[model samples]
Target chain A: MTSVLEIRNLHVSVADKPILKGVNLLVKQGEVHALMGPNGTGKSTLAYTLMGHPLYVVTGGQVIFKGVDLLELAPDERSRLGLFLAFQYPVAIPGVSVANFLRTALNARRRAANPADKGIPIPEFRKLLKAKMDMLQVSHDFAGRYLNDGFSGGEKKRAEILQMATLDPEIAVLDETDSGLDIDALRIVAEGVNKLAGPNMGALVITHYQRILNYIKPNVVHIMLGGQIVESGEADLALHLEERGYDWVREKYQEKAEA
Target chain B: MSEQVAELEKLSEYKYGFSDNVHYAYQSQRGLNAGVVRTLSGMKGEPQWMLDFRLKALDIFNKKPMPTWGGKISLDLDEITYYTRPSEKTESSWDDVPADIKNTFDKLGIPEAERKFLAGVGAQYESEMVYHSVQKHLEELGVIFLSSDDGLRQYPELFREHFGKVVPPTDNKFAACNSAVWSGGSFVYVPKGVHVEMPLQAYFRLNAEGTGQFERTLIIVDEGAQVHYVEGCTAPTYSRDSFHSGVIEIIVKKGARCRYTTIQNWSTNVYNLVTQRAVVHEGATMEWVDANLGSQLTMKYPSCYLVGEGAHGEILSMAFAGPGQHQDTGGKVVHGAPNTTSKITSKSISRAGGRTSYRGLLKVYKGATGSKSSVVCDALLIDDKSRSDTYPVIEIDENEVTIGHEASVSKVGEEQLFYLMSRGIPKDQAEGLVVAGFIEPLVKELPMEYAVELNRLVQLQMEGSVG
Candidate 1:
């Protein structure tokens, strides 16, 4: 059975100002979707709202994932249900090693799935971490570093992808993961995401550029403007938007409102 | 009420609140006087000179005024019972100890820790040491480990030579109080060139109500010797506040090294004011690792007097202040000799309307050229109602000295919390992890067992902190 995320008329407000105004979209397992928009177009807001950030208050919305309303769950509960958000600016947690944090997160998910589960054994966890690090081309020493503390921009982005690979979420939301990376770092991170996105996993790639879309091919493309997804089409639509930009879309929406 | 406040209240419950019904061999009359001091010394069978010393200390206690700075003190010194001895004499074997006293120590895991890693153990109840033991090999190595009273009687010459040399009775009001009514603390003497690989631990338990615990500890590490000493304290809860004022003095001889670690978790109804200082000789080192967790109010600053050239001192201090608690703690270092070095690092956490302050002092006297010192204080406030402060005093008369001080105050950021929680950790655990990370540097300095226990205690304090 395939998993589906149905976001219908989602309205989210931050500090009494609406950022996501009745946005609607659908993503399914085994498919990669690209969400393209300019700055302040609610692309990040939609991503944060999907992951249940406390600051993004839902004024009106229904985000149904696997037939359950995602809006009613806590962030941890959403994560236990296999939802993940690769933050654009991942915060630093000083003195917490990446391996320790991953193990804790993995144990939390495991205990939620089965209350009797103790935790991943140390040797087993080491093996699993080594395998995932190898696949992502991340150095073994990366696991020993404090999570994102004093990390460079590229290291932080790669850390996010490494986390995504280890968690293996069913529906992953990559929110501007390519923003801070250099070309080499971007290819490494993009390739990591590609390796993790499989038949059992789905991804919503949110970005403002078409450069990352070249590496991680998306089957469906959606363009967001002024707090809503106004246009969506095949993967070629991202190429079209790259050439024409959002000016034409803004003009079309203004014409519709005036009529 | 908000869920956060409710959770904080729930987490503030004291786990070591249970009391035991023990038959005290002798209990002193409530309130303090010169007669009480005389009777305490007489009961200990101390010599004439020691009695005269106590009398002088009692006079100083009466003349000195209460301190006007740091946390507010509501202690009614006149109403406190100054002495309560649970046993007639210290027991060398655990089985010889009274069942009730042994059970109390058992509950606190004193014996278990001794068997696991400690080279010696001292279990104190009220104002007397009830159980004491040292490993056979350590005893064979000419190490002197005994109760302070026994040290006075058995090693009189050595005890008299070093007793008040480091911390005289006139050091502070509390030090005077402790000198006048001191009892039950450990006396350790490591001979020349001998190194004790394992730690010697002392656990103090205050089971009675409205009583004062004055344990005066003295340690002397001879030339080229080394040892590590750890002390832990806890008390049963009571409506009226108890008092604990201890004075610990150590002398690290030339080329010797000594470490003193303290994990103080007294009941919330206790006033803990302790004065600890060490005199480091040439080429010697002294370290103080102090962690303060539970108390109504605490004002303690462990100090090191670097009186010899090339001596070194280090202090790692941590404090946790919960509801209705105030912890004013830090360290002090005096560079009195040339080329001396010192470092003081302090970490404090305040939650649920609690308050913590880091008050430290670093002083370099004239002619103490090339001395280097740095002080760092970091405080974490868990809630808006909690409070933290840093008071760092640096006085340097030497123009050639180097000094640096850094202080930071941080709250658990919402972004960090969201990041962790979004990875499947719950809110409270996420906060606990962040706090654990905040103190990781100091925790790593502790022994494995102590580091683990400190982390567990921090987690317990963080429960329901986020709602």
Candidate 2:
């Protein structure tokens, strides 16, 4: 199967300080990849770099998405290229409602996908939004509220997933969505991700714990240390890291460095 | 004045710059004088006392010096024509108006907006109201909606009692000028215990060149009554500066409520200086929703006097200043009686080297015990070149009063823009969303039509200013 996204030797810096020092990864359709490491290991930096944040300067990198060079695109252009990032902390836009935001995103994506396609009509958009909200178990009233404004931790996560479901991006990067969510919220988010994951969608689930992997099993698990991936294994590797902690990974990396 | 007009002529992109080709039946000489005031009074056939009031106001206007505070203004009094009448008399039907004048109001969306959801409608062209109408159902409910001139001719006793009570002639220089040369505005009166369910609207258009429009509006909501009045102002762009100095006074009597909403969008070469105030009596409420979007220099502070126990006042003001604009606007509250309350929320946006300032005052008199007041001012500067300022004066002599003031100035956060763009929205649209969000509290308080129009204007202003 052709890979949906490929990141090769990606180096990024913020404020002139290098954070992601040559990271490599690949995501293919119909599969879930987990990138896990301790705090301050630059996992979030990788997510931001992939999403084209201006603050995260890409020093040396090549990001290829569906045969196009993603590094040369703007954030909104990358989003139209079917790339999605569920932010660790979603920003609150006080007056833009969830429905309006989703509709705008959907239209932008549609225009990029097909030049001649008109935007979805309001009634049709409402119907599709209703279906997505119902599938994600999001309250109907949530769509009328401002996007992420005054939303609780769980509500923010659910709203993100709801957006992902509406946009139907080809590849999605979930950046620490389980950080502040409780078990119930974690299950709901994982379920939403699972329902949308198939031959049509690919996901890179970035997290710090193996707790969420229990709900959404990953095809491959990668252990990142200091800015680069140090190890890759099957799903059981996540459980092993949970039991021995990041120290075990650090020791393994240290042996390799010394050699 | 000719030099400024020559300068403004260099920028020809003003959409509403075209003037109609029509004859003015009664155009006064191009200046403010006692004879001009007398001629206006004579033309309206006013009583001797009314003429005396105008003459006294003219004396006050001459004695008082120009205001020195707020934004810098270079208006030459000698260059402004105080009055001009586009038609001989007010018409009750739009078809009866002169075709040229009718076409002007037609382009401004007067009758269409009136037919939408207005309980009463009034259209003013230049110095005089050309058309006035009220729905039959509302007229049957003992509601009196008429032009100020008609109010004086029809209900002289009522007009004489409360015409200049709230904003007197000597209140300020602009107030005195407006009192001296005022010509066209609305006079609305809701009887005791009757509520006007729909909004009464008036549209004022300035189509004459080198002229001044002084509209005097007075609204009285009697005991246990309720009313809402909304007015919109627009002016055709003239190379020479046009002036708009209006006096809006409202009286919310015991247990009554009144809301006054204004949306002012003049041409860039206009100076809009005005005084608007209200008096809230016992158990009454008064709300002022003012939005200023255009003009070269505007200094307006709508105030309220809480004259009875348990009175309440609310002011929601929004200002957007584009290039070559300075909007100095805020609200004032005077708690003159016991247990009165007031709240003021001001939001302003400045971009493209424009400046906005919030100047407000809150006063609690010596015997106004147990009163509470709060003021919140938030300003957003879209770029480094733009500026925003806040000046709040709070005076409290009553020890038992509670007063709070909060002010914040912010630049558009880069992170916020990135977050929005990551969702597939373009950069210009992203910036527009952020601005609309910033002023959401104030815009949401406006009527539906005005809120939509404000959002559209905000979007248009954000097109080229986004990073």
Candidate 3:
């Protein structure tokens, strides 16, 4: 059976101001969807609401993943239910190594799945982490450094991807992961996403620029404006927006609202 | 219900709340006066000069008034049993120790630690030493490790020369109290050019209710010698508050180095007031590692006096304050000679309405040119109800001295918590990880087993803090 995430009439507010208004979308396993729009258009808001950020209040919405209500759960519970958000600005946790954090996260997931389950043995966990790091082309020394503490832009993005690979979430929402990256870093991150998306997982690639869409080809493309997704089309729609900027989409949505 | 029974019921959650049923060979009456001091001195069969010293100390203790700073104190001096002798003699072999007392140390893991790494071990129960031993090789190197009473009885002249030189009875009221009724603490002397690799450990336990334990520890590191001394303390919980006032004096000779580490985890019904200081000679170094985790109220400031040229001192202090606990601890460094240097680092955590304060002083004398000092204090508050404070004083009379001080107070931010929890960690465990990171710098300096134990204790303290 294929897993599905259904977002219907979702409304979100931040600090008493609405950011996401009546948004609707559907994502299924083995499919990649791209969400593109101008800045401040509720792209990241939708991602944060999907991951249950406490600051993003869900005033009205129903987010069901695998037939379970995601909005009714805590952030940790949402994560344990195979929902992940690659944060735009990852926070640094000093004195916590990447290997240690990953192992703790894995153990938490295991214990949640079965109450009587002892955590992964140290040797086995080490082997698993090494395998994942090797698969992602990450240096072994990266595991020893403190989690994102003094990391550069490219390093932080790479660390995020490394975490995504280690966690193996079923549905990942990439919220502007390409914002602070150079060209080389952008290609590497896009390749990491491409490699992770398969029949076992689905992805919602949220971005502002069309350059990343060129690398990780999305099966369906959606344009968001004014707290609502305004356009849905085939892959060529991103190319159309790249040729002409969001000015045309703004005008089009303006005419539609007036009518 | 009686007060004692009610206190025992409240101590069910404490790990070391189990008390022994052994009979004390001798116990002083519940009071402190001239007669009590005389009886304590007479019981030890001390020299006349020592008796005179105790009598003078009693006068000073009576004259000094109670302090009105740091944590609050509600102790009644007239209601405390000042002296208790659990066994008649200190046993050199573990098998010779009384069964119940040995069982207590066994549960505390003293013998296992001794067999694994410690060069010497001293177990003090109530007011007397019950078990004492040193590795045969260290004993062959002219190293003297024994109880304070045995040190006086066997090596009187050496003990008399350096007993109270570092910290005298006139220093404070608690120091004077310890001076009058001091008993059962470690006495160590490392000869010139001899370096003992393993640490010498002392474990102090208070068993009786409404009693006081005043242990006097004196260590002397001779020229070019090196040693590390560690002491850990814990007591059973009771409704009636107990009092613990100890005085530790150390001397580091020319080119010698000494490190003293203490892990204090008394029960919540105890007031722990201790005075520990060391004097460093020319080209010598001294370090103090102090970790305070328990007790209703604790006021301790370990100090180092750099009295000779080219001396150095370092202090690393850590404190954890849980519900109804107040930890007032820091370090002091005094530079009396030229070309001296010192450093102090302190870290504290407060949770569940507990409070912690860092009170420190750095002083450089008039002629102590080219001296340098640095102090840093960092505190973490786990919730809105917790509290932390810092008071640092620096006095530099010399124009050519260098000084630096930095302090920070931070709460566990919601963003940090959210970031950790979003990765599937529960709220309480997430808070625990952040706290472990905040105190990582100090915890890394502890030994392997102690580092593990400290982390475990911090985890245990964080369990019920989150809703």
Local distance difference test values of all predictions, in order: 0.83, 0.82, 0.82
Query: iRMS for all predictions?
Result: 0.5, 1.2, 0.8
Q: Write the candidate numbers in order of decreasing DockQ.
A: 1, 2, 3
* Candidate 1 accuracy as TM-score: 0.89
Q: Candidate 3 chain B, which ten residues in sequence have the lowest lDDT sum?
A: B113-122
Q: lDDT tens digits, residues B185-271, model 2?
A: 878889999999878766422221112368888899999999988887332222223577989989999999999988876656668
Judge candidate 1 at residue B90 and give its lDDT: 23
* TM-scores for the candidates: 0.89, 0.90, 0.89
Tens-place lDDT digits, model 1, residues B89-128: 2212333222333343344445453321111112333333
What DockQ would candidate 3 receive versus the native complex?
0.69
Best by DockQ: 1
Scored by lDDT, model 3 comes in at 0.82
Which should have the higher lDDT, number 1 or number 3? 1
lDDT score of residue A59 within candidate 1: 98
In candidate 2, which residue ranges exceed 4 Å CA deviation?
Answer: A1-3, A111-118, A255-259, B1-25, B88-133, B204-212, B233-241, B465-467
For every candidate, C-alpha RMSD to the true structure in Å = 6.7, 5.2, 5.4
Range of the 10 consecutive residues with the lowest summed lDDT in candidate 2 chain B: B115-124
Query: Residue A173 error for model 2, in Å?
Result: 0.3
